[model samples]
Target chain A: MREVFQQSLRDVQDRLVLIAELVEQAITEATTAFGSSDVGIAEKVIDRVEEIEILAAELDQLTIDILARQQPVASDLRLMVGALRMSASLERMADLAQHIAQLARYRYPESAIPAGLTKTFARMGALDVEMARKIVDLLRTQDPRLIAEVRDLDDDLDELHAKVFEKVLSDNLAETPANVVDSTLASRYHERFGDHAVGIARQIQYFISGSLD
Target chain B: MREVFQQSLRDVQDRLVLIAELVEQAITEATTAFGSSDVGIAEKVIDRVEEIEILAAELDQLTIDILARQQPVASDLRLMVGALRMSASLERMADLAQHIAQLARYRYPESAIPAGLTKTFARMGALDVEMARKIVDLLRTQDPRLIAEVRDLDDDLDELHAKVFEKVLSDNLAETPANVVDSTLASRYHERFGDHAVGIARQIQYFISGSLD
Candidate 1:
């Protein structure tokens, strides 16, 4: 029975890693689509949202089933709770990626980055993609060091988020209201993607350290 | 043992209601501060965020304890899962409310509603506060009927969200980029608050009906 429970725990971990990989793929494609104005790639990311949601739902069911069958306690139970949260965060990361892709699709012929803010947006997108990659690694390996790495990445993302606002509010941009709205929303979506990444990292940290700090 | 589990379940329900009530107050005060540029009230809402978060964490620990102690299955198990999710939604609702209040505080003495969209923002704020109130009621009563009510309110809120974007993009507003940024973010925050409210309603629906639809 103990071995069986361990297998179920491994199953939970594998599923989380799978979902995180999908999230990484979604964000990578999403950033690429947003930066290059590639509508086709954006459509691909949009179409995968439902797939990620279904996978997340399945993962939740599996965790519930494990709790019912295995009744894991102590560290094992913490793993179950963390699995549920990590799945939710991973799913949210996918949704944010979809939102980013939709922005690119909305401005198919035109760029969503607005004038004078393209480089800033490019850096922001890169940061989000890197964060997603680190999340995938963190989930697979459960390395405590990656927790701080993800948090530091979020700090950088936050700074870029503030920079996006600063640039938009500055007089030198000469952007239209539409550009301002899109840039604001897009920057927010990117920043939120990083936040969700940090959320996942925190969950992993809690599961490993038995503390939420 | 069964009776003890029942009491624990009741405890879970009561805590959820308590957190929901706090969320309702947060959104109510937040929208009021947002509308009136009342920084004092906004600060009140901001200060309570940690309170809500702490309550949520305590609820999570209690649910985990229940799961470990009683090993509830089927409907009871669903309740535990739903409680975790509802707690998350309610906490997110509070965070969104804080964001709205921060906007008000940041633009103190200067309304964040921009020039032409004041009425629209007022309506949006009202919808959010109404949804928060309904969430508190739904958590307390577990009435499936409130689920539909919450969904409909979100629809109204979403329409207002779209209208805000429309007005922002229109030429007649003659607003600064800062105004555009604030309106976009404020509208998004309000919309997300409604989304979290809908999320809690859905969790209730699932607990009652055993279907996620």
Candidate 2:
């Protein structure tokens, strides 16, 4: 019975890493779709999000089952709880990625994005990819430092977001109104995606340090 | 020692409700400020968010103490976990209210809301209030039905959000570019605020049913 519970635990951990990988792919595709105005890629990300949701629900059931049947104690309980928290964060990250894709598809027909705007978005995407990688690393290694690094990366995302805002407001007043709205919304979603990533990092920190800070 | 732990639990529960009330006030102020373009009310919400943060951290510590000292078993453990989860959702709700206020202040210098937008915003605000009330009632009563009611209210918020999206996208295209951007961001923030409220409702549901729908 102990072995069976341990196997389920191992399965949950493996599925978590898989979800992280899928999130990374979804975000990358969504960012590329935004940068290139590729509706097809954006549509793919939107379609794949259902798989993320299914994985999340299944993982939730697994955690609840482990808690109820195995009756995890002490550190084991913490790990199971952390897994549950991580799943919610991961699911939200997937949703944010799908949101970005929806916005990208919404704007694909209207205008050519300024090169500078594309560059800013590219920087944001890089930060997102870095954050996702660190989350996976934290899961694999259980390293606490990477969680702090994730918070630092979020600071970089905020700087990029501020730049996007200033550049759009200063330089794009004469552009067609739809173009401005689309670009601004895109930037805001990217910033929010970083925030959610940082949230996941915080959950990892709580798991490692047993502290919410 | 048991009595001490019970007292601490009650303290934490009281603080949670207080935070919820303040957050409700913040959302109310945010909605009114947005409709009236009242920067003062917006700033008030932003200022009070710090208090919510402090309460959130305090609640976190209290929960940890309850778990470590009381060593709650069975449904008691569930109650402790539920309080921690509830604090997290409420903290985020408070943060969202602050963000709405920030958006209001951000667009204050040139208040150029289009016609009919305020009514839609007002309706969103009503839905937000309803959602918050249902969540508070659930927390206070521990009644399972209120959780479902909260979910039902979230559906109404979703409908309002879709209507706002269509109205803003189709009607605001010919406005001055800055006005269009500001209004778009404002509407997006309001829509997201509704989503966060739904999140709170879901958390309440989890507390009652030990599952999320």
Candidate 3:
């Protein structure tokens, strides 16, 4: 019975990494779709969110079951609880990716962003993709240094996000309010995606170090 | 020992309601600050977010303790897990409110939104306040009608959010791009707050009925 519980716990951990991989794919494709104005790719990312959602829910149930049956204590309980939080954060990160894809889909045939800001949005999207992939690597490797690196990466995203505002508000911008709205929201989505990655990093840090900060 | 565990569970539930109340207050003040250009109120809301954060963290620790020590199962375990999710949703909602307040602060003295669209944004802010209040009432009452009502309220926010886009994109709009950016992002913040409230309502419903829908 103890072995069965341990196997289930390991299974949950494995599934979490798989969810992280799927999230990485979704954000990468979603951002790629953003740059290329590929409705097909964007649609694929949107479709993939359903799979992420399913995995998130199943992982949630697995965590709940382990908590109830194993009645884990101390570090084990903390790991289970942290797993629950991490699952929700990853699911939300996927939702943010979906939001990005939906923007690409909404402005199909035309790029979601104006001509001047495509490079900016693409940069933001690339950083988010890197951040997403790093989350997977962090989970697999459990490296502490990566947490600070992810934090620094999010700071970079914040800078890029501010620069986006700078570009949109610059005198040369001739885009419609509609374009401004789409680009700003999409930029916010990417920035938030970085924040969620950082959040997962903190959760892993806590899971290992038993510290919140 | 079981009785002691039940008491701790109840305490956690009580604290959860307290955190919800703080979230409601922040959104209320933050939106008020948004319209009035009241930097003081906005700053207060921003500072109060720290309190909400602390409460959320404490509540989380309490839930972990109950789960680890009590080994709660069935409905008790479900309630605790739901509480954890609700705490996160509420904290993010508070962060949204802070973002709203930060916008107000960022654009101090002058209104963040254009004069023409102020009414539309004010309406959206008012709806979010109502939705936040309704979340507390729903938790207290567990009335399914409240859920439908909250859903309807979110629909109302969505409409207002659309109208914000309409006003921004309308001809004869003379606001600076900076003003447009602030208004759009603030409007998005209020819209997301409603979504989080609805999420908590669904969590409550699930806690009661044990159904996802």
Candidate 1 per-residue C-alpha lDDT over B46-119 given as tens digits, one digit per residue, 9 for 90 to 100: 99999999999999999998888888888888889889988888888899999999999998888888879989
lDDT of 3 by residue, A1-213 (tens): 678777987898899899999999999999998889899999999998999999999999989999888898888888888889899989999999999999889888877798899788888988898888889888888998888888988999999999888889887878878788888999899998998899899999987788869
Q: After superposition, how far is residue A95 of candidate 2 from its true place, in Å?
A: 0.6
Candidate 1 regions with alpha-carbon error over 4 angstroms: none
DockQ, every prediction: 0.85, 0.35, 0.82
Measured by TM-score, how close is model 2 to the native structure? 0.83
- What is the fnat of model 2 with respect to the true interface contacts? 0.32
Q: Which runs in model 3 stand beyond 4 Å of their true positions?
A: none
- Distance from true location, Cα of B57 in model 1, Å: 0.6
Best to worst by lDDT, what's the order? 1, 3, 2
| Cα-based TM-score, every candidate | 0.98, 0.83, 0.97
Please provide, for model 2 over B61-140, each residue's C-alpha lDDT reduced to its tens digit, 9 standing for 90 to 100: 67766665676666666667667767877888888788778877888865546665667777877777777766666556
How many pairs of residues collide in model 1? 0
Off by over 4 Å in 2: A1-12, A65-77, A108-116, A143-145, A172-174, A206-213, B1-15, B64-80, B142-152, B171-174, B203-213
TM-score of chain B of 1: 0.98
The lDDT values for all models are 0.91, 0.76, 0.89
